[model samples]
Target: MKRVWGSFFLAMSEAIVPLERIHSLIVVLRGQRVILDRDLADLYGVTTKRLNEQVKRNRRKFPEDFMLQLTGEEKDKVVANCDHLRNLRFSPVSPYAFTEHGTVQAANVLNSDAACDMSVQVVRAFVALRHMMINHKALSVKLAELDARIGMHDEQIGEIVKTIRQLAAPEGPRHRRKIGFHPGNR
Candidate 1:
């Protein structure tokens, strides 16, 4: 029975936030990929208010790179992009956007078993996202190179086609005097 209960708990915790779900929660804000305070709080099984309170108490731990409060425009963009965050569209306060490091720090400050576990998952998700971005950048570079090469080849092919067409065209008529008889000489 102990083994059965342990397995059941494991299943439940694994379902808390799948990697794909965490990926969807990430967004680019202010040129940095971040997760919002509410999303992190949900993953950590805490209220956003509680998370913010804890963060405020440990304010020294978080730095500019770790976290930042969104501006009104930034908040509006987030609300527009994420349907679930529509509630923030009218809120007087702007939500915090946490960087990868801030996320781990938040988990440490919270001191919850679930928060600690979710922190690891969040890191993994962030790492995966970074790798994917790098791969996409490489692919973009390769595509640009291919397009440049094709452009050069197009010019060469056009010259070849023009030359072929000139060669295939028939020559103009040629006139020659009679070899043996000429009326003027007679």
Candidate 2:
């Protein structure tokens, strides 16, 4: 059993892909992060038509959040926005976009060695993205705190400069008026 598990892990490792490659394939649509059907198909080592057919057959497995069909307008907008997806403009049917859950479900429907291996990789990619986002939020908070500290120092420096300027200015001589002297002796 240990050997079996080890081999299983080895297979999964063999399928592991670079985070950058998977990250590039991810796109945000309607505020949801998703991977296009064509891209998923490529990862699964199957034709796009075959993959869509499987999804249609296992429609019950996919909920709204799992898989969503792009509307004509949305599809057009995606095509316009992404130069790499330009071919979609000519296709009659817009490709389905699969969220993280949907992507894993797709692998189950595919039920192939390559599908299973790549599915694990896909999940890892999504997790990595989430981790990075969390780190970014923490960094943003730290930067905001540093900015506030610097602002406070600036105010202190400004007050010090004002005091220095006042001390440096020469004091003019005081002129005292004679109270009882009104002599016009030129």
- Candidate topping lDDT: 1
Can you give the TM-score per candidate against the true fold? Answer: 0.86, 0.81
- Model 2 scores a C-alpha lDDT of 0.85
Residue 19 miss distance in model 2 (angstroms) = 1.8
Residue by residue across 141-183, what tens digits does model 1's lDDT show?
Answer: 9999999999999999999999999999887877766689777
Candidate 1 minimal-lDDT segment of 10 residues:
1-10
In model 2, where is the ten-residue run with the lowest total lDDT? 1-10
Top TM-score hit: 1
Local accuracy of candidate 2 as per-residue lDDT tens digits, 1-186: 121221223353265556677788888888888999988887776788989999999999999999999999999988887777889899999899999999999999999988888988898888888899899999999999999999999999999999999999888987867677588933
- Give the Cα lDDT of each candidate: 0.89, 0.85
Per-candidate RMSD, Å: 5.3, 7.3
RMSD (CA, angstroms), candidate 2: 7.3
Enumerate clash totals for all models, in the order shown: 0, 0
